[model samples]
Target: MLRTVNVTRYIQPLREGGSLPALAEADDDFKYVLKFRGNGHGPKVLIAELIGGEIARELGLRVPELVFAHLDEAFGRTEGDEEVQDLLKGSQGLNIALHFLSGAITFDPVVTQIDAETASKVVWLDSFISNIDRTVKNTNMLMFNKELWLIDHGSSLSFHHAWMHLEERAKSPFPFVKEHVLLAQASLLKETNEAFKKLLTPEKLQAIVALIPDSWLEWPDTDESPEALREAYSQFLITRLNHSDIFTNQAQDAREALI
Candidate 1:
């Protein structure tokens, strides 16, 4: 489970994407990039962000520390912007945040080259989660202190939006790997996939899925309990990891075509 923090101030709204995440100061005297629960996708996006990010970290990738940010009901009452005010009000509860990287710049593949191992790991992680982002146009990666850091995983695990035939979805070939920005550089897919499979055991996956907030799992008109939802996510990931070869082969073939 993630440590909780009280949001002290709203610094600014990050308008990079539709979700409208913000840069804010927390009670711990540190700034964080806060993902609100009031966003259009609601808590589902937060759930994806947490699961994808933690899994990446466990796979030895650079991911910022995550925390559960709390918003008071009156936090944004005086804001003159009606749009911002409504968003704040609706998100007056537990939200997700990442430690803000102060001087990070968007990753430019042209300027900086990633080695085969790192690129392969990133590609494998993205494929495992079925992440739709991380294309050449929008990498959703940052270069902080000359090291690559991943962020904005809200778009992964899209199966949650329509939770039917989840096991079938887990076995998807993930042909989208052809468009991944790092696919060409992921030359060690086979080796990396085998190594990563050992790192993410069923117990580790269950622990990660258990971090999802109970409130977030309470989907509208859904009959499933939070525990059941967590189990579903865990099972989906376990099944996907077990059948890693489907996507690994897809990625290897895609990489071969590029080369």
Candidate 2:
């Protein structure tokens, strides 16, 4: 289970992407990159972040700590920027935040050469989740303490957005692995693919999917209940895991073309 923290301060907004994630300090005196629920995709982005980040952690990959952040209504009144105020007001309930890595640097493929084992594992994990953000343009990874840590999974598990023919989408191979920044280094795809299959069992995947807050799963546009939505996410992941070969082969073929 994830810990919940109350945001004590609204530090500054990070303007890199459309979501406008911000740096804030919590009651625990730890700084975090807060992903607001009121932003672009709303709670769906938070759901993806929670699910994707936890799955990466379960695979023994480096990922910053994830926590449930509560934003109070008072924050909206003090902000001078009308846009920011609206964002805060809209996000008054619950949000998600990643523990800030104080001196982490953006990952540069040229500067940081990952070993085949790690690279293959990362490739397989992203392929499993269908995360499209780990490209050359936006690696969504950081180099902290000489370790590769993944972040910003708001674009992951994208099948939830369309919410149609989900089983088909789950069984589909992620062709975008060709564009992954680590494709060149992912030489152990076959070995790691088999290893990861054992790591991400159906029970484990369902447990990670269960981490998503009920509030986030209550889709505003959908008539489906929160429990149903959670079950859908769990089943989708399990089905994808059962058919991991489709994506693993696609990634291997892509890597072969690169080398």
Candidate 3:
């Protein structure tokens, strides 16, 4: 079960890349990336990441193992709003420290491209759930244990409301053919669809939806119950799964490539 933890010590920061307040563990017991809320330009960004990361895990995605943590006040101070701080404390500091994938490295989008089959699977998953984070520049995927591990889902779902408008709603916001790596490999969609169907059950989907904070939902006047939200999200998934040709094609392509 996912739970909160008390981080005892401060870890070294990873200087090369990453936009948030992230650090690498010093002790070798478990290499972890500690994401924190600091007094900076984007404190709310980290909070979004925590929620999205947990949601991805619940969806059966190959995300890193995550643990919600509390930073020692002595480490540093966060310049976030009181509401944000309260929300974090209410949700255990809104910090998600993920177990780092050691011996794994991020690849250039062109250098280590996923086969059309895998791309189809990934794109299908993202689209059904309204994930807009996995773009051409910021795929947020990793190669670990001879397989793909997805990371950094902070930019997905509720956080993407700003991009959602009348024009955007008319067409699929996620056009895999133009943006994803395996656009030409459309056949993988079938395999991905099957895998998604097997993993995303009504019960699991409900549980995950229930876990979402009421504060995250955009509709101010919409006082929908958690169960209602679950049902709605589930319907959304079913509708997209049935109608999305990209999902079907990509899953098939991915399955064939693996064979």
Q: What's the lDDT for all of these models?
A: 0.94, 0.92, 0.54
Instruction: Put down candidate 1 lDDT per residue, 116-179, tens digits, no spaces.
Output: 9999999999999989899989999999998999999999998999999999999998988899
Candidate 2 at residue 198, lDDT?
Answer: 91
Q: Cα miss at 88, model 2 (Å)? A: 0.9
Better of 2 and 3 by lDDT: 2
Q: What's the lDDT for residue 29 in model 3?
A: 52
Q: Judge candidate 2 at residue 130 and give its lDDT.
A: 91
Candidates 1 and 3, the one with greater TM-score: 1
lDDT, residue 233, model 2: 95
Residue pair clashes in candidate 2: none
The list of candidate 2 runs beyond 4 A from truth reads none
Instruction: Write down the TM-score for model 1.
Output: 0.98
Q: How many angstroms is residue 38 displaced in model 2 relative to the true structure, after the best TM-score fit? A: 0.5
**CA shift of 73, model 1, Å:** 0.5
For candidate 2, write residues 26-86 as lDDT tens digits.
Answer: 9999999999999978899999999999999999999999999999888758888888888
Q: Can you give the lDDT of residue 111 in candidate 1?
A: 94
Order of candidate numbers by TM-score, starting with the best: 1, 2, 3
Model 3, stretches more than 4 Å misplaced?
A: 13-19, 24-29, 37-61, 77-92, 113-116, 158-173, 213-259
